[model samples]
Target chain A: AQSVTQLDSQVPVFEEAPVELRCNYSSSVSVYLFWYVQYPNQGLQLLLKYLSGSTLVESINGFEAEFNKSQTSFHLRKPSVHISDTAEYFCAVSATTSGTYKYIFGTGTRLKVLA
Target chain B: SAVISQKPSRDICQRGTSLTIQCQVDSQVTMMFWYRQQPGQSLTLIATANQGSEATYESGFVIDKFPISRPNLTFSTLTVSNMSPEDSSIYLCSVEDLGRANYGYTFGSGTRLTVV
Candidate 1:
């Protein structure tokens, strides 16, 4: 079984400031890590993911996350956030089970970027 | 990545009623996932539907309460039976992006059900 934990329920930051949303997971086997963003009234969009090889993965929108196997963590980071970056971020871990993959998601963190 | 179109974007249903949500994928998929997100919470996997097989449900969910159907490779449906206030939540459908290296999942916009 796999589980994901997001410690911060809400985070507030001013525009152009850096931000990080923490995500930790526990799994018995190798798993794939992903970060998803859900904007207001919109569907979830994939931010970035770490499958293998590279420890760090980046999204086109300037968001990045590093897969730290030692720490069992995949934290999302952005150098500068914009007001439009306000959204709910989720961390998920997918592991193969019964020849199929199952995903476990974190509780989610709400990012609020203020100008 | 496969694109999903989920129907019944939102609805207000009375207790004891049932609502069925649909998902249509742009491409063929071997598996489709259904999830629930309560108010201010993260997503919880409800079940995994596969074509020509019985849907596999999670620990806390049951087939009777949330019946699932997968008639083909590109479509599936989830029905929330015996609705109550506790069942009020956003229901979403998802599919894995086999074409991408990350193997990330694509999600539907979700159906927001408000039980009254």
Candidate 2:
């Protein structure tokens, strides 16, 4: 089984400021990490994922996350934020070789971008 | 990624009644999953709907409470039974899109159920 933990419940930042959303996971085996964003009254959208190859992964929307194996962390970061980035972010984890597609999500961290 | 659609985007139902949510995928997928999101909470997997077999439910969820049917690769349905105020939440269906090298998952818009 895999579990994810997002340390911050809420993170507020000014527009154009850099920000980071912390996420950690516990798993006995190899795992796949993902970051999803949910806007108001909308379903989740995949921000990015870290499967293999590089420890760092990036999304087209200028968001990036680094998968740290030793620390069991996959923290999401952005150099600059926009008002549109104000949304709830969730961190998810899944076993890499379980043959099952079940994902364990964290409680979530609400990002508030101030203008 | 596959384009997915869910029916009845939002609904209000009486307690003890049941609602069936439909999910359709534009492309064929081998696996479909049902998830529930409580108010101001993260998603919880209810069951995995596989074609030609019984759905595998996660812990704390039962087949009777949340019955799932996957008759084919591109279509599935999830019925919430014996609803209560606590059962009011958003139900979403997701499918694994293997076309991407990372094998990411795509989710439907989600059906919001409000039981009164």
Candidate 1 residue runs with Cα over 4 Å from true position: none
User: Quick one: best TM-score, which candidate?
Assistant: 1
- Residue pairs whose backbone atoms clash in candidate 1: none
TM values, all candidates: 0.97, 0.96
Q: What is the lDDT of residue A10 in candidate 2?
A: 95
* Interface root-mean-square deviation (Å) of every model: 0.6, 0.8
- Candidate with the greatest lDDT versus the true structure: 1
- For A54-81, candidate 1 gives per-residue lDDT tens digits of 8988999999999999999999999999
Docking quality tier of model 2: high
Model 1 sits at an interface RMSD, in angstroms, of 0.6
Count residue pairs with overlapping backbones in model 1. 0
DockQ of each: 0.92, 0.84
The lDDT per prediction is: 0.94, 0.92
